[model samples]
Target: MRYLWYLLPWQFSPAVLTVCVLTVALYLRGLLMLKRNGAPVGFWRPFVFFLGLAVSYAVLQTYFDFLAQHSFWVHCLQQLILHHLGPALIVLSGPVLVLREGLPRAGRTGAPRVLREMRLDWLRKPLRLAWRTLQHPLIAPLLFVGLIFFWLIPRVHFATMIDTRRYLLMNWSMFADGLLFWWVILAPKEEQGSAAVGYKVRLLILPFISMTQIVIGAYISLVPWQLYPIYALCGRALAISPMLDQQIGGLLTWIPGAMMSLVGVIVVLRHMMREEEAQLRMSPLRAETPGSSRPSAEVA
Candidate 1:
């Protein structure tokens, strides 16, 4: 039991703590603003948003952090949750909408107005460019896949594990990219107009992305030799054999990661179907059909 306790990675990360606190603060501020304005804030929005934050803190700041550093399989599981599940929940929580509505209204005179104007001026151009770039159907998925490949390179992966800065960068980048990719796919209808890539295009490209992840995971799992030297050089802290650990990691990435991508594909398909149904309902031909009972239908 003491050995197990020794194995636990309980080191505090100031960076992780700061980030988690900021996330909660920002979200709470938005919720407060929403309530002040008499907006109907659903219970689930805050719940899911906070859940994502909690998952992030769990993996980065708790015992899971130690396990991830020591075990290949645990690291893979961490990535899956951080890059796929956690971000999905955050996006679903509708932070963008909440934040937008939460912003104070600008007025002709006062410090609040001045602050608001300055904030808008500072944010407008850069935010617009970022939004445009992310909205491109190919950009988010390609960047996401590219990041996975980039980090999986033996040298890159080893560097990240050895260097604290690099490790933080890897985790934060994956989280940010995950949020962007999922938000592109699952944004509310009012925001869909800003997306450069239509739902059909997003749907078409998703399968290819899923296939790439599967291929990468399969390669890692099937290889006879270990790709990462650090895992071998640094003794395995857990009971599992290095080879078995590598295989488990590969399978986790191959299966659960692909499943998350599949969920995005399903969302896109549903959105397309809904749009098609709406279009059909609004069609003049449908309204004028012989079976229709309205006066306009009878005139037709």
Candidate 2:
């Protein structure tokens, strides 16, 4: 009976709950559109894919993050899902076809109208703004490096540990920033209005970015010194040795997180290459004129 509380499923933060509910609602709306006679069938697959991802996220949060005992590896896994994988998957699963069809029959007239307008001007204003911002070239490299530096800073890391708001804010912000940075570089040219870089370029750039973390982790791992005093306090509170705790946290930050980043870069680079090749193939063919006989030849 004493361990009954631990047996209860994990609880989600309000933000997670809201997102989950919205995802489910959107999925249902898509289904409703399918049933309606006038609605288009374009949105079903994308809606289903996104809905599935949302449900997977919910399960991870409820079963792994909320219910399981606090372990560094578990925390790393959660971060991989909520931060690295989730944002990219959701963005890639944009509701272009589905939203177009579903929103019309969603029974929400205002939203439908707005979405229609957005569909007309989507890339022009909102998405264009985001695209330009993310592709600055400066933003991605800086963010890639800055996140590690900020994480290593004693005050910043400790602040995150002490304040739930700070922890959530820092992690979520970095994750969003990372996704946005990559999105600009990897998004389809039609949507982005500018060709994404070649896959070869991305392969180089992505590895270069990931290497920063490998270096940071190596440095932290080699240093015998304790960078954060809070680790000692946390160790005492949690009844784990301070050195072991710090090492575990460092490993979580270093290995799995870095691997996730590297993997994303690889995938995005591959997509960029395929997009470039497709564009090359689809480009208008140049008209070739056969050599014209000299007019002088007729006179001769």
Candidate 3:
């Protein structure tokens, strides 16, 4: 009974717990400041903090369960959640303005020395040259669909076939890439630019991207298949029961990930619309005032 602390994976890694606690504490402190001092909870702060907490919980839970016994399906579930859902949330959580004020002044510095030395011109050339090529309307949908199949590859799914460490790294890297790629099209204008297409246009595009996962999952679920054979022995040895586990994993990936991502797109679009409306309302008042745009209530 005294050793109950062992039940928590966060206890095993003080660093992970430390980061999670600090992040939540910062958000809570910001919330208190907003309540008391009329501070704004910057656009992305709430979402970023939410993402951090969710990822931390998912990672810790997976780590501890793995330590208890290596179940192939459990590992797959963890990877899918960490890479597919978690990192996407993390990226969407970005451009946090509330957290901006909380950060020390040092972090606000622009263009580090390392960045200055990096030859960005060469890298930026192709992106500029073939902006249209890079802007293929199908790229985002393909990435989302490709991710569904890529993970199911027997080599990737099988833990023993590849180095577990490398697999984890690849999963995280791919997740990050997916987030960045989609963001190029779906990203909010407040953080980037107000393009020819408005937030409403982006809202329409989001459904197409989100549905890719659902279609892939439904196909896999209905088909007769064994996508990850290497895991068969491991699952049997570790009592994972692959068929049942795979079905659940597919459902988990298909349902929550797509739904959450669509929700994020909707939230961002709403935020953009609200900001635009506020600006429009303020514009007329600013124009009417001839002198400085400050409120005039001077009685001495």
Looking at model 3, which ten-residue stretch has the lowest summed lDDT? Answer: 291-300
Query: Clashing residue pairs in candidate 2, if any?
Result: 43-98
Best-fitting candidate, scored by lDDT: 1
TM-score of each: 0.82, 0.65, 0.62
Summarize candidate 2's per-residue lDDT along 167-239 as a digit string, tens digits: 6676566666755655654554344335244345555666666677667666665568776666455434345
Ranking of candidates on TM-score, top first: 1, 2, 3
What candidate 1 gets wrong by more than 4 Å, as runs, is 1-9, 102-116, 119-127, 277-300
Q: What lDDT does model 2 reach? A: 0.56
Instruction: Report the Cα lDDT for residue 269, model 2.
Output: 61
RMSD per candidate (Å) reads 6.1, 9.0, 8.1
lDDT of 1: 0.77
Clash-forming residue pairs, model 3 = 42-98
From the highest lDDT down, the ranking of the candidates is 1, 2, 3
Worst 10 residues of 1 by lDDT: 291-300
Which stretches of candidate 2 lie above 4 Å from their native place? 1-12, 31-77, 92-131, 194-201, 229-232, 235-240, 276-300
lDDT of 3 by residue, 159-199 (tens): 43346565545445555555554455445554442222345
- Per-residue lDDT over 162-182 for candidate 1, one digit per residue giving the tens place of the 0 to 100 score: 998898899989888988888
- Total clashing residue pairs per candidate? 0, 1, 1
Q: lDDT per model, in order?
A: 0.77, 0.56, 0.54
Q: Report the C-alpha displacement of residue 77, candidate 1, in angstroms.
A: 0.8
